[model samples]
Target chain A: MYVDVILNQPASRDYRVYIDQLETLHFDTKVLIVTNTTVASLHLETLQKKIEAKELYSVILPDGEQYKNMQSLNLILNACFEHRLDRKSLLIAFGGGVIGDMTGFAASIYQRGIDFIQIPTTLLSQVDASVGGKTGINNSYGKNLIGSFWQPRAVYCESVFLKTLPKREFSAGVAEMIKMAVTFDKAFFEWLETHDLEDEAHLKEAIAKSIAIKARVVALDETEQGIRAVLNYGHTFAHVIENQTHYTTFLHGEAVAIGMVMANILAQKLTFLNADEALRIVTLLEHYDLPTHYRIENVEAFYDAFFLDKKSEHAVIKFILAQGIGGYEISRNIPKEVVLEALKEANA
Target chain B: MYVDVILNQPASRDYRVYIDQLETLHFDTKVLIVTNTTVASLHLETLQKKIEAKELYSVILPDGEQYKNMQSLNLILNACFEHRLDRKSLLIAFGGGVIGDMTGFAASIYQRGIDFIQIPTTLLSQVDASVGGKTGINNSYGKNLIGSFWQPRAVYCESVFLKTLPKREFSAGVAEMIKMAVTFDKAFFEWLETHDLEDEAHLKEAIAKSIAIKARVVALDETEQGIRAVLNYGHTFAHVIENQTHYTTFLHGEAVAIGMVMANILAQKLTFLNADEALRIVTLLEHYDLPTHYRIENVEAFYDAFFLDKKSEHAVIKFILAQGIGGYEISRNIPKEVVLEALKEANA
Candidate 1:
């Protein structure tokens, strides 16, 4: 199955996201496969055999989120220079979000942009990161603080690659899938409640459904100016959670899962989501063993951190709240006391 | 006077290039003016006084092409973060090509791209670099080997900024203007022969004319997929010249001036230009005291260097040769011996 990401952009920038469809790819240009040590060790040969290029090279980066820095970015770029990859050359991102983001960022700036393909190995990346063109390395200030909205040439997602995924990591990917379902598709949310993703056939359908929703949202607002922000249903809170825990305690999707529950609390305050509706979402996340709670040590400190988020402009925090199921509200000017109340509730 | 660069891109990407027009500007968001030491010492205050923002900051990098690297780019990006500049904030590139390229590149990646204005200080920048959305920093491999096609929101070109420009630099700027005329406008080329740019009014007219030509060419081919390569009429030879001299002997425009002469020799070989037409170009370049000749040390080495240029793809050098004045040709498969003979003649 495949989802066409029809971005309301130049036809050149629009691409498709294929689910469980990894075909024999061929290119007449220099091709660089950028993967991490973990993915390289497990699945590099599988990916390598599928691609035939005039020149093929792979750069193995150390696996982990912490390695997603300028040093790694330079490693990818230096590899391009060393291999003499030109503007027409291509890059294949063959790992999780870290590899995809770094490879996409490298392609965006290499010779003022080049074509890059995303072969997402992790479910987290396949469902979310690989679909969006948000590519950048982190700085001392924050995550994805520096990046470009450079879309990929195409994205290939294969379920076979996920056979080796750790159980926790697999659940983390479900968090993003759940985030998509809760915000945009109550039917998808209901589908998740009834179906078991552990079954490969059911998992493929969910991935396609989630990517289709994401593609539609991205098409509406490629730069996250409007409806695209709605896709960040849990990210506003998730960013703060990740930063507070130094990104070591929780996977990004796991934080988003907890973030969704926290956002549901705020939605209850705003009457966007009823208690029963919020409970259903939490029950589904827990079914997948996804974390749906967090301890906020200092509500004030967390509140301050929202102002530092890239989405929060000029001290105005845009909260993405679930308006019951399959609906959302972007609350830009919610009173501080009301948010503090929700934070207190989430803390409890 | 102003020339609107109507890029066939999204409406948000199209911008205007204002010549001899630097007006008071205001922004509701934080603004950072990126300049260099030399430009800051002379005109930072001039530029700063004309802009009012909620918060204003300036980062003065060391001046020169050598400083146009990752370090300077980092300095600008770090300042944006330090000032807490958000997505809505703006950057003003206030210097020559080096500052403009670095600043524009920083804006392109900072927070996944933001709005920036160009206030070009040098004649070379005002007429050329400031108008193009090409933003990048040089690396160990080559000049502008890494960058994005990020157009600025607007460009303000004030001849007043040129008051402090050295005479040699001014002539170098003229080399680019001459290049624009020779490739796109025969009438403009003829007018350039009779007119004296040393006169302020004539210089302003020439600047506007050159920019208008650039604006038209850019509008047609924003990504240099086709006709835009014509703008690099002299650059094919110039890159080699710059590389050979380690970029210390001549300004970029000066090197381009010599490169134009070398290209003309090749063009004459192809019967693209008569001997008189070629001499006219050389005479105009010499009239401004721009370097019209560079003795090639090794014809074979210089020919090999062309392949290293980013424009060269798959070891195929695409030479942008003048097809007499006001016309150009993008020759993809020029025979080796013919080009070698031209190089040998230029060697003399």
Candidate 2:
């Protein structure tokens, strides 16, 4: 299946996203596949056999989010230099979000910008990271603290890559899918309340539905200048939790799962989402085996870090509050005391 | 005088360039001035006083082309992190091409992208570097081998900064002005042949003319996918010379001066530019006290490195040959033997 993403900006670009099985990938230009050791071990042979190019090379990085730093990013860029890859070369992000983010960031800077494609292997990456033009790596200060908006020439997402994903990671991916339905499509959220996602066919449909909503949001606000903030419905709180835990405690989707719950509570306090509506979303997260609660070390510290968000302006931090499932609003008027109260409510 | 450069690409960007005296700059956003020790020592105080911002900071890197690498670029990114510079912050490139290139590259990847204004402080930067959206850092591989296209919010080209530039640097700046004139504006090239650039009025008019041509070419081909290659008319050979010398032998504009002479020699060989026209251009460089000749250490070695250019496609090197002056073409028709002959001619 092919989906189109329109970046209605200067030097207007539109790219096709292929989601199905992997086909023989070949390029007439220099090509580099940036992958991690884990992914390489699992699928390198199959990928190597199926892909052909004028100059195809691979740079293997160690797996895990900890390695997503400037040192690791340089591995990809240095490979480009060592191979003498020019503007005509292409970079293929062949792992998960970590690889996709780093590869896209590298392509964005390689010779002032080159072409790249996203082959997101993980469910989280397929539905979120690879779809948006947002690409970055974590810094000592926080997650994705460094990056830019560089859309890929195309994306090839194969569901087969998820067959080997561990149960915890698999569940984490579903959390993001649930987040999408809750934020944009009420009927999809309602369907999730009764559907059996364990079925392969059902899961694929859910994934596509999630991607379609994300594609719509990105098309409207490629730079997150406005409506795109709604896509970060749970990311503001999620980034903080990841930062506090050094981004090593929970998978991104897990943190975001709990973040959505906290947002629901915040919305209830403002009378935007009633108690029943909030619980319905939490119950759905539970059904998906996603975390719906989190504990804060210090509410004030989290509050201060909130203002440092890439989405924030001046001292005002915009919050995405749920009006009801599939309905949300971005507001900067939430009282600090209300946020502090919500933190206490979310305490373990 | 104000010049406008319209980037008609994805997320099209347009900004005005102020090309006259220094004016007080006041921005409500957090701002950081990324400069080198030499340029900062010369104008930091004056700049600090004239620029009013919510929060202002400075990162002083050592001055030189050799320092334009990833390490120096990180200094700018690190300062941004230290200040907790959110997306709303602005970075001011307050030096020559090195500063402008590094600062603009930093802003392009800082939080995946942020706002930056170019405060180009040298004549070369005003008429050349700051006019285009090209920003990058030199890696061990080559000159500007790493970077991306990131347009600045605005470029403030205060010719007043030229007062402190040493005589050699002053001459280097004039070489770039001559390159712009020779490549895109024949009238401007003719004006340079008889004009006294030492006169401030004449210099300002010359600088404005160089920028106008650049602004027009950039508007049409922001990515260098077309006419933009004409702007790199002299850069191909210049980059190799700088690479062989480890970017320490001469200023960028000085190397470009010698490179233009080589380009003219090749153009004459192809009958694209007659002997008189090439000599007229050479005489203008001499009038500006710019080097019009360079000796290649190894002609064959230089020829091999030419294929490594960001402009080369499928091992085919494109040459921008002058058809008289202000008229050019991007051609991949030059044979290896012909290029070798021209290289032998450039040998001392």
Candidate 3:
């Protein structure tokens, strides 16, 4: 039987994460589980127990963003073909956002189209990547510049896996949560200000809220035609940081945390957000031990990379700026000088 | 500006191929022409003159079905990334079916995705692969078991390319047209029996009709959910032949020609198609000098290969059978003994 988990915007439901029981889904087809070392070591057993298929296998890829390249993607696809998984087979993306993107991409290409499910373990993934069907791998040029807006059949966000997540990794997930609250829901942001997310109940509620907001945004604009770019509130500068460091130094959400501060500074200068309000947001980020700034080795190179972003067009950078906390606007053709000034102020 | 070509089903309008001036469509972004050695040598200069882009370059991959594997697919994708071709950069698939599939797949996965257009040169591709958005490369396990249903931004079908195609290759293309007619349009099948494809105008009309039918079928069921399976009328058996022959012995259309005969025999035995009608289809195939049978090394092994097909459900084999000349049905769980009998008869 098929189950539809639709709840407002970012719906949250308690999902079971087990292994070797995939047969219970009543699908008599091949099941390909795409994952990396980190999740494979931590939760592969449980996932395997939940997937008891007639022909079940795992594509264990290299861990980390560095390995999230075309070479690794090809390796995963090769594994899919080697296993003879047909179009009816289900591909389970059993890892973080990287694994989800790569496996989703594999499923998207395998026989031109096939079914895939998202089993997001990381908090960041559970709240964001697992919901929308945007799948892709990174390139030397940029992240997610070459990808598809392919959605998954289902998503299983098992909070059970997050228990093993390191404090820093868990906080990285919170950075994205904060992004959702700040841009989409002022009420949610106010709740976060008073609530202690370290508490289990509060954290779960926060995840549900974040996912609900993201889901609503995605459902309304699956292809990022309009409101979806608001979802990239901090991604503009974050992508530059990730690119500058070659995706090695900072976690994605950590970089995004710094990016949010940069965006806030820009918003303040544009009179979109008050300086005191922006400072409060930064102070809250520090409360979670998130970074608020990053050093750029080459400003010109960093600035140039924005044009190469998937969201950019004809040298026009699509920047999602806040009109104020809990409100955002997607602006195109923001002058290079304006961006440069923001960059300077962010560094200052 | 973007152009969308919709080939109208069953009409000659879709068949009459036209070569529009490529220079007229201008893009500031880089334009990448992906092709093989054979096609490049013959038409690269002509194609280059047509493409007036700010930045233009070509990546000539090794030609032939043998090279249509993951290694080559990655080579094409890596080349695009290495060149720093971002999302705006357009990939032009400038060759036959292999080039189209591999190039489209490469573009689909680069950074998540980039736009691609098809310029099919082979008769087989013009009537078949070029119309559908299915793009992928072969793998160690099977042919086209890995790929995505990525539609091209536009498709340019210049019938002028057919003048250079080998006679055997031209016959190979006829195989798919026959499959389309016999399974979906009986009138078209009768027309093929009485007409010779040597007539360029008539051949173009048949191609256009077949492609229009394919495009409509694919558009309705882009993900192969239902009626789309009809497109695989001969592919079920053709895949086994290609796998057994290591994809070196026969052009894809040639193998498909032999496959249609097998499907016809099966349809006759099941009383879905009359024996006399099957003979008429075989007679038309003979006129084109296409293969109607094959020498099987091992029937069991050949049957085993069907399970490896992308259409199969787990280990279950699926067959597209005709109910009379133009009627079709998708059936699975057919007795293995019956399939083996068909394979033996195909060899006989």
Candidate 4:
């Protein structure tokens, strides 16, 4: 199954996202595969055998979110230079979100942009990160603080690679999948409550459904000027949580899982979501063993961090809140006291 | 006078290039003016007084082509983060091509891209670099080896800034203007041969004419897929010249002047340009005291450096040669021995 991401603004920027499809990929130009040491150890040979290029090279970075910094970005670029990969060269992001984000960014700025494709190994990246064109790296200030809206030529997601994923990482992927359902698709939310993603067929369906919803949102706002901001349903809070934890404690999706719960408390306070609906979202996250709470060490510091998020314009923090199931509201005028109260509650 | 660059493919990318028109400008968001030590000392206050913003800051880098690297790019990004400049905040490229390229590149990646305006201080920048959306920095591999095609919100070119420009630098800017005329506008080339740009009125006309030609060619091919390559007529040889001399022996425009002479020699060999026409170009470059010749130490090493250029694809070097005044040709299949002979002749 595949979903076509149609960006009408620049018709040429449109591409397709294929699910469970990994076949012989042929390229007439030099190709560079950017992966992490972890993914390289497990699946590099598997991916290498499937690609045919005039020249092939691999840049294996250290695994983990902490490694997604300017250093890793440079590593990918240096490899491109070392191999003399020109404007027509191709880069394959052959790992999870970290590898994909850094690789896409490297491609975006390498010779003022080049072609790249995504072969997402983890479930989190396959369903969410790999689909959107938001490519960037983390810095001392925040996550994805520096990047470009560079879309990939194509994306290939195969379940076979997930067989080697750790259980915690697999659960982290489910968090992003649930984020999609709770914010945009109530039917999918209910389906997740009943279906066991442990089953291969159900997992594939969820991936396709989540990607379809994401594709629709990205198509509407390629630059996140409007409807696309809603895709950050849990990410606003998640960024602070990830920062406080130094990106080592939680997987990106795990932070989002906790963040969603925190956002629900704020949504309830804003009267956008009810108690029962909020509880339902929390219960579904628990079903996948995803973290649903984070203790905020300092509420004031956390609140101040929100202002630094790229979403905040001037001093206004635009919060993407769930307006019950399958709907959302972007509130830029949320009072500080109201947000502080929710943060206090989440701290428990 | 102003030339509106209409990029119909993505209407939002369209902007205007204003010549001799730096008036009071206003912005509601935080603004950062990126310049260099020399520009800041000469005209920073002049530019700062003409802009009003909610908050204003400046990042002054060292002035030189050697400083146009990743380190300078990082300094700009660091400042944006330090100032907590959000997505809506604006950046102003307030110096020559080095500052403009680094600033535009910094803005392109800061928060996944932001709006930037060019206020070029140098003649080389005002007439050429500042008008185009090409933003990047140089690396060990080559010049502008990393960057993005990020257009500025607008461009403001003021002749007042040129009051401080050294005579040699002014001649360098004329090299680019001559290049524009030789490739796209024969009438403009003939007029330039007769007009003395030392006169203010003549200089303004030439700036507007060069920008108009550039804006038209850019509108046709924004990404350099076709006719846009013609703009790099002298760059194929210039990049190697700069690289060979470690970017210290000559200014970029000065190198381009010499490169144009070298390209003309090759063009004459290919019969794309007559000997008389080639001599006319060399005379015009010399008219402004621009360097019209360079000693080639090793033809083989210089020839090998062309492959490192981003313009070359898959070991094929695409040479942008002058067909005659006002016409150009992109030749990819020129037997290299013919090029070697031209290099040997230009060696004199």
Q: What is the interface RMSD of each candidate, in Å?
A: 1.3, 2.4, 5.9, 1.5
* Candidate 4 lDDT over residue span B148-191, tens digit each: 99999899889998988999999999999999999999999999
Q: Which lDDT tens digits does candidate 1 get at residues B249-329?
A: 999999999999999999999999989999999999999999888988789999988887764687888888888899998
User: Number of the top candidate by TM-score?
Assistant: 1
The pairs that clash in candidate 1 are: A112-B147
lDDT of candidate 2 over A1-348, digit per residue (tens): 667787676444678778885689778888999999999999877777777888889999999998999999899999998888888899999998999999999998888888899988888888888898888898777778788888999988788888877887888888888888887899999888878788988777787788888889998988888888887788889989887787778898999998999888788888889999989988888887888877787889988889766546667888897778888888797889999898788784
List model 1 lDDT by residue over A1-348, tens digit each.
Answer: 888888777787889888877789989999999999999999999889999999999999999988999999999999999999998999999999999999999999999999999999989999999987999998888888898999999999999999999999999999999998888999999999999999999999999998998888888888888988888888888999999998899988899999999999999988899999999999999999989889999999998889877546868788999987988888889999999999999998
lDDT of 3 by residue, A25-139 (tens): 5457778888888888988987788676768889889888778777887887777767776666888888899999888877777677777888887889988888767888776
Q: Scored by Cα lDDT, where does model 3 land?
A: 0.79
lDDT of 2 by residue, B19-47 (tens): 77457888888899999999888999989
lDDT of 4 at A118: 97
TM-score for candidate 4, please give it: 0.96
Worst 10 residues of 2 chain A by lDDT: A7-16
Lowest-scoring 10 consecutive residues by lDDT in candidate 3 chain A? A12-21
True contacts kept of each: 0.80, 0.89, 0.76, 0.89
Which of the two candidates, 3 or 4, achieves a greater lDDT against the reference? 4
Cα distance off (Å), candidate 4, residue A169: 1.7
